[model samples]
Target chain A: MSFIQTLKQSVGLSTDGLTKRKTVTFGDTTAVGNGRFWSIISVITLSMAWYLGSALELVNPIFWPAPSAVWDQFINISQDGYRNFTLWEHVWASLYRILVGFALGCLIGIPLGFAMGLSEIIRGWFDPIVEFFRPIPPLAFIPLVIIWSGIGERSKILLLFFAALWIMVIAARAGVGSVKLSKIHAAYSLGATKRQILMHVILPNSLPEIFTGMRVAMGICWGTVVAAELVAAESGIGFMIMAASKFLATDIVILGVIVVGVIGYAIDILMRKLEDKLIPWKGKA
Target chain B: MSDLVVNDVSMVFDTPSGEQVHALENVSFSLKQGELLSILGPSGCGKSTLLNIIAGFLAPTDGTVELASTEIHGPGSDRGMVFQQGALFEWLSVAENIGFGLTMKGTPKDEIKKTVDHLLETVGLHDFGEKAIYELSGGMQQRVALARCLANDPDVILMDEPLGALDALTREKMQGLVLKLWKETGKTIILITHSVEEALFLGERLFVMAPRPGRIKKEYSLPFAEAGVTKDPRDVKADPDFGAKREEILNMIWEMEEEIMGQAEE
Candidate 1:
């Protein structure tokens, strides 16, 4: 008998097999379960601070409008249409550009990244081109994309795509390269084909990074959408903000900024949820 | 039915500076079906390099590895390997990691699930099927790695210091587990480690390798491999021949180490 096994058995605990069975406690009636208490306390504290801040006028009132004033502006914008576009229309255009561009980026970048990950030859061929092009920011491509695709939806979408693609490429490269060699061998010993090794062993192992890439790409997607609108758009939040800036309407510009922030936050939350769903093992990470 | 024949195997790796470094040379060995052989050596003795070649992850420059009269050119499910590091897929659950090979081979989902559960149970991790790799401690992660390898049901299990990362207590426990599993599964096992005590305790025959183009310097048939040898590990360690054999192997390794380092200086 092993020394530890004797000791554990002496105490009536068993460690006879490959695993030791143990019981664990979860968040049933613990301090972590006090959702109501936490929710109420946070709201109370935030409201008190807001009330005090409004009375003192501590920040730029026009730009950092009071929460209640911002709420009012939100409702007002929904009610009032501007130049054949409501707040929702502006939101839709911005979100459309981001989703389309981000999707295009994934379509191009994911395959390219895996190709580079699989073979040194592919990496050697592409690394130079990627390094040369990636250093220049996607917004910098605005002038060039305009020259080629014109200042239309194509140019705007391409700008967003280019921005998101570089980030995804970097993330994917890291993911694939980081997969352990032993895992690949393990798969090979299991009669896995080359494609099987990549799809099952390499790809699944690197999912944490792949999801990180998606999150980073989506964030870049939003920023690119805003930049794309700033250059040429009649109907995005960036256009709305720029148009409002011309009229010295700081409240409207702040509203546009708020809209962009909320949209970015919402989509990021969705991506996190998707990551959790796809890789339930993420909690370990 | 599954047996290994490694014939006059030798391996060499060249440094980036183009210097040829020998790892193994003229190392020949063969294992009968279900034989458990342990390789004990000093560090840098190419034990792992030899094992990798057998696993088909590396190619021997001067010899061939044949399994059941077939030349081994690449990895197959016929030769499972357990790395010192667990290397479980971080993003996969224990069951998914265990079933990975099956999934890759297009096994039916139900069959894969059944085999994964059976494997988890065999490895004594039945309830850990849903757990993630990181959720387990070091020893437990190694068990998960074991289950993953066994789930593939290979003809041979090549372990390269599989318990080297664990604490002393866990390593001993895992050694027992490995022996028990090897017996029950009836698979040919080739284990490589630097620990003398481990080799004496676990191996039917111990192969002592020397460094600097590692070659099998001595093959010791230990008393523990005798049918009279006790199953208890402590008893095996306490056997009269244990200390003498350990000393002899240790001296042989030390001499090789001095020779290799001297060669490097020259």
Candidate 2:
């Protein structure tokens, strides 16, 4: 088959006859063409390839440690500790910083965004400042943060906070701005006070967008937290990785990288689940 | 005494390029208590502008709208509006939507529930109260919109092409519901529509309007709406007078459109 045909078939879009079947019936919970099954298969295949390549010495162990070596390093770190802090300590420290920074961002950013969305004067006042700083990388603030706050937890948390705030503000504003004029008119005609409209109509309608912005902010916060820790931190996953790299402990570095990725992925999944619960009517309308 | 009076209402909108668009000009009318007034016109006739002005969503450049001898200022629960589309909050259930106005007014929870339940029944949506707005069909959604508007027990209901989006069968059914609601509640209603049949069938007092400085061209006091209370809408439409009035209005609108096109060409 041609590449385009095969691609279409893979997506279940090629067959005209199948397209006519509106009702979908699954044979079992573990369907062959299910997305979860494909994901598992892909992960297994990649792991096998990594194991084989390392076992055959296709890559130098010094540069790219074997999966087993990385696994051993992970176990060792939990028991023996890395740089006087255990694996749990490093993970907890990073989690604390991220949580604090993200919480602060949401607290201020959400209201600011709503204000900008609601009033032209507020939007005009903040638009320039938000736009000017939004495009700059969070890492770019490292030097100034270090100079101002020193290499303390405050600087690290502040960096993550900045990363999350801009994303949240923009999200909230966009969400508020997008509410249909007709809906507002309906509210007004129904004799809603300005306060009532703000609470009942604008807030609920803007929630989906706010939730989306939160998810994006979370991803950015996670990335920024690690970079912040790498720049200057006594204990964190980023610190562990940085420490390991300096000593040429490739296995520990790999383990730290995997841990960071797994934690970030887990946080994203949690956020998505919360979004589904909070905004159940998001796409339905 | 009139329930609502609109006197010398005019709206002029200035575009960004310094051009003025006259949306409505010298539009004057008075609606009696419990009367159904339908404003019919071609697309740009500013019928919607007039409705918005009455609803207090917009301020007319000139003139006053008085309800019960008091001048209108801003939107209040006294005047309820049903938009062309349902304009319902998608996140809210049918019952919640109906109760929104009551809730805003700080009505007791039990009273809100009772009123909303009654409204749901009146609109024939008793079973669908718990259903989300999006779950219902277009016709059902409009029914909920009507129920929501009526829940407030406003002195006047302003509907801007409330059934414009419905299919032909549903539109006819909704028109009947409007007539029923008018008879039952005795609330004054001003419905704006582009449909000549809908205007004649639902309106006892009909205003035919022309665009290009949107103004009322003619007014008719028709008996079809009264006849429709007892007779089938189709039967009412079949009357010779209904045909003659429809043809006359259709020609008037056609001439207005032609004049607009000729001006555009220039």
Candidate 3:
């Protein structure tokens, strides 16, 4: 069985114990109640299939290392350092770069977006530049960043900051643009000054969009950081995976991939939890 | 006493096609302090346009609106507006939305809370004070809208199809609430609606407007609104005079719609 299936079963997750047969009814397909159970089952099933397929030597071991071997590699990396740096050190390096880059992007981009959204002159001035850079992937700038700042943390962080900047700017602008005219008029009629309206109505209304942008930017930053590290970095999950792949260390590569995926997934989950707590009225209105 | 006077207000819009369309023409009317006026017409009627002009959201090409002898240049604390829907702040609780006006005017915190609490009770939404606006039903949201407007205690309250989104039963209940609020608060109100029954029931002075180059076609001083305050709205709607006026205005608007359709076909 695939390591994931074994992991699932080990964690006390199995649908086979439920006595009632789940009849897949039409129209209830989108219903969320039993869907979560099915999702877990699907993951468990995939892991089992991978495990069986590998044990039977159905696929080349070079491409798909056996789950147990990958697990062993994970345990090996946990004890012995990968390339002079521990797994946590690599994870911390990647996370530090992402945090600093994402923070810089949010700090500068949101206010710029607000300004562009609020003023026609500012929008006109910046729209061309934002639109020009937005579609250009963050990875495309790695070479330029490396050339300018050298293949160091600055280059990697700068690339990630640029990757997050345009997304946040567009998001903040959209958030400001999303304020309904009736709401503004309502505020004005209630004797709110222009500043008060902007602070209370416009700012609060834009928050949901800002949160959505942040989630998207975080995901993009995660992907961009890995790609950037693969291109140059000497100490990161991406670098470790890249380094392992050169030596045909399939198990180490698989383990590194899993670690990166897990960290990215964890970050997203944390963001969603924070979003739910902070903006409880999101989409409810 | 605050009297809202619209002196020959006209609105002309220059369409992108380069044609200057007269949305309103010389739509003049006066509302005495504590009066309730309902402007009713067909779809293209500038009844909403007139209301917007009076609310200072839109400027008229000609004429001016004066409230309590002061000309309205823009939206101010003297006027409060209730939109049909989507006007209440979704991010805020029902109490916060209601108290928005007072908070904006920088009223003391305790005073805002006091006014919001009283209005919450007034609109029968006392228990929903802490509830987010989206949690409420359409009728309840409108109740919040009404309470929010009333919280400001403006000289003139403007409503644009405030109960148009509610179901028939809820609408009838809200109609009674409107009459009750009007009678109790004694604030001049201008309500715009296409519903003939709503116009007949809620208006102390009802104006039936014509569509093309919209102007007041007819005026009716009705007893239903004053009676609706003390009696069941069903009883008010059951009045012969109310029925006659409803039919008359419906026919007037129906013909206007037909005339517009004919023009479109031509």
Task: By lDDT, rank the candidates, best first.
Answer: 3, 2, 1
Reference-based lDDT, residue A123, model 1: 94
Candidate 1's C-alpha runs over 4 A off are A1-71, A280-285, B108-114, B225-230, B264-266
**Local accuracy by lDDT, each model:** 0.82, 0.89, 0.90
lDDT of 3 by residue, A1-285 (tens): 779887666655544533336566356543324445567778999999999999999999899999999988877777887998888888888999999999999999999999999999999999999999999999999999999999899998899899989999999999999999999999999999999998999999999999999999999999899888898989998999999999999988889898989999999999999999989988887
Candidate 2 regions exceeding 4 Å error are A1-17, A20-38
Considering only chain B, report the TM-score of each candidate against the true chain B. 0.93, 0.97, 0.98
Q: Can you write out model 2's per-residue Cα lDDT over A1-285, one digit (the tens) per residue?
A: 699887766754454554346355465333233355456678899999999999999999989999999989888999999999989899999999889988899898989999999889999999999999999999999888999898889998888789889988999899899898889999998889899889999999999999999888888888887888887889999999999899999999999999999999999999999988888888877
Q: Candidate 3 chain B: minimum summed lDDT over ten consecutive residues — where?
A: B241-250
TM-score of each: 0.85, 0.92, 0.93
- Clash-forming residue pairs, model 1: A189-B77
lDDT of 1 by residue, A118-173 (tens): 88999999999889878786777888888989877787888888888877787788
Q: Which should have the higher DockQ, number 1 or number 3? A: 3
Name the TM-score of candidate 1: 0.85
User: What does DockQ come to for candidate 1?
Assistant: 0.49
What digit string (tens of lDDT, one per residue) describes model 1 on residues B1-266? 67799999999879999989799999988899888899988888888888988998888899999999898998888898888884677777889988987887788999999998888888889999988788888888889888888888888999888888899998988887887787778889898887888888778888998777788988977656442233677776777788888888888878887887888799
Which pairs of residues collide in model 3?
A1-A51, A2-A47, A2-A48, A2-A51
